[model samples]
Structure formats: C-alpha cells, structure tokens
Target: MNIKSIILGVLFLFMSGQIALAQSTGTEREITELSKKKWEWMADKNADSLAELFHDKAKFVHMGGTWGKDREVDIIRSGGIHYKKAEIHEVMVEVMGETAILWNRITLLAVVGGNEVSNPFMVTEVYVKQNDTWKLGDLTFSKLLTRD
Candidate 1:
C-alpha cells in the first residue's frame, strides 16, 4: 500500500472508533437522564417512580448520612421529602460496561415537614444495566449549605 493509503486507512479506523464511542456515549447519556428523572420524582414524592428504579438490593443513602433500603423506603414513604420544583444543573457520567456512576448537582424546592425547603445538593448514584435496562444500584446525597 502507498504511504498515503496507509495514513488514510488509519484515519478511517480512528474515525470509526470515535463514532462508536460517540454512540456509546449517547446511549449512556439516555440512561443517565432516566436516572435523573427518577431522582426528580423521588424529590417530587412520587414514590412509585423512584421505587421502580431501585434494585431489590439497592443501597440508598440519604443526606442525613443513613443507609439501608428498608430505611430508605420508610423515609420515602413517610412523605417528608417532596420536590415541589427541581432543576438539574449538571450531571457527569462515568460508564464501564454495564455499570455507570453519575455525579449530579440539583436544586430542589420542596415541602418537607410542611415547611418550604429549598435545597441545593450534590448526589452520586450508581446504575447497573441489567437485561438491557438500567436500574439504580446505589445513591448518596450531600446537601450544599448556602451562606446568607
């Protein structure tokens, strides 16, 4: 093969790989978006939507720094947390095969304990692709303190 042909072939291969990567990234992005929607529903106090995403053995940790699915369920069920208005400002996703970790920062205007709660927080969630569907495997939230 001529030198130019070799270079052209290499460039084609590189572009093909990039296209594949971009496609993968796009798919991963969809999964991440779904996960975010679930979180939004969680804060919205739409219990069922949040429940569906959680794996049976999923680990859900709260801003209070507590762990356990049952406890998380109890908290979710008790109705203290509600996302009256929510906005996702940023989301960063890292994917490896069937697993993904998403780091997100969201602002929530909610009603908690009958008091209006405006929370700006950061969350990290792990999602696992199972049977060609993404499910929430783990979640943690940290509240951001605002200096008035």
Candidate 2:
C-alpha cells in the first residue's frame, strides 16, 4: 500500500478503537454507579429497592452460605445480617454484551447475630441487562486475610 493509504487505514483504525473505548467506558461508569447504589441500599436495609434490582433467580453467596433472592431480601428486611457500612477501596468492572461483572475490594462493617464486626472482603457482583434494565444476577463475598 501507498504511504497515504497506510496513514488513512491507521487513522480509521484509531477512530474505531476510540469509539469502542468510549462505549465501554460509559458502560463501566454506569455499572460502577449502580454497584455503589446497591451498597447504599444494603447498608440502609432497603429491601424494596434491592428486590427491584435483583433478578428473580439471583443467587447470593455469603461467607456463611448461599441463598436465593427471596431469602436474601428477607435477611435484609429482617436485619438478620445488617450491613452497617461498606468502605470500598477499589472497584473493577468488565462488560460482555448485556452482562457485567464487578469486583469490589472493601472493608465491611456488619451486625451478624447481634454482634457487630468488621471484615475485609473482595465482593463480586454480576449484572445482566433485560428489557433495557439491569438486574443483579449474583453477589458473592470472599473474606480477605488483610485489608490491603
């Protein structure tokens, strides 16, 4: 190819890559904000809002055990495991088509069985888009040895 043609091709590729990057960045921001909101809702024990966000078949994996959406909502509503606060240190998000996976490194203050405690955790959240709305499909918390 001629020098001119090569430069034109390179420019086109650059523009295409930029467009893709912009789209992904937008998605990342949206998912990150939604995750932040979810944490707030959990701390506030807003089961109604959480119920709306969680998918019908959503699963929750805690350090104690795994459960489905309804049970999870009940736990929140009843203050069975009160989420007092989540101090997020870092978040990473990835989008694949209509699905997004978010990872959060956090120190969580919670009341479990009437005992207040704090722990460092790496939390994973999975979201899927259906009918133009994002629903949480999974949430899992893995305890960390150190806060980092």
Candidate 3:
C-alpha cells in the first residue's frame, strides 16, 4: 500500500471512532433527561405518570424509613407526604451503558397533613433500561435540612 494512502485510511478510521463516541455521549444526556421528566411528573402529583417510571421491583428508602411500592402509593393517595413544588437544584449522573445512577439536591415545598414545610434533600435514584424504557430501579432520600 502507498504510504499516503495508508495515512488517509487511518485518518478515516479515527474520525469514525470519534463519531461513535459522540453518539454514546448523547445517549447519556438522554438518560439524564428522563430523570428530569420523571421528577417533574412527581412534583406535579402525577402519581400515575411517576408510576410508569418505576421498575416493578423498585425499592424506596425515604428519609424517614423504608417503604415498599404499596406504601408509597398510599402515601401519595392519603397525602402523607405531598410536594407542593419540588425543584432540582443540582444533578449528577453516572451512566454505564444501560444503567445509571442519579444524584441531586432538591428544594422541596411540601405539605404534610395540611401543614406547609420546606426541606433540602439529597436524593439518589437508580435507573435501568429495559425494552428501550428507563425505569426507576431504586430511590433513596436523605434530609439535608428541615424546616417546620
């Protein structure tokens, strides 16, 4: 092979690799957007929409304690913990192809039994891609600050 031709072929392969890498990065951004959408539905009290985001075997560990899917549904229905508005202040996503871990800080304006409350929370959520859908595999919350 001519030296110049070989050089040109190597350059082409390198550029192709870069394109694949860029597409992979874009897919990660899409996963982060999914997390954002799910949180928005949660803040809106759209439990049905949020439900669609959860994995069937999802587990939740709240700041208070552990709870299963049934308890979570009940809490939403009974207004045990209701978010009037929840804003995500910071978000970090660690993606491993088909799975991701999301961490974020939220400023929550919540209503508990007709009383208004505010809190700063650190939340961790796991998402797994299944059948082209990202589902919440786990949710855990830690209270950074609480105001009565």
RMSD of each: 2.7, 1.4, 3.1
The residue pairs that clash in candidate 1, if any, are 43-83
Sorted by TM-score (best first), the order is 2, 3, 1
Per-candidate TM equals 0.78, 0.93, 0.80
Tens-place lDDT digits, model 2, residues 24-104: 999999999999999999999999999999999999999999999999999999999999999999999999999999999
Ranking by lDDT: 2, 3, 1
Off by over 4 Å in 1: 1-12, 146-148
Error of 2 at 62 (Å): 0.4
TM-score of 1: 0.78
User: How does each model score on lDDT?
Assistant: 0.77, 0.97, 0.79
Q: What would the per-residue lDDT of candidate 1 be over residues 1-148, giving only the tens digit for each residue?
A: 8999999999999999999899779867887778768866776666776777778788866655666566666666787666576677888888888888888787877776778867788878888888988888988877888511
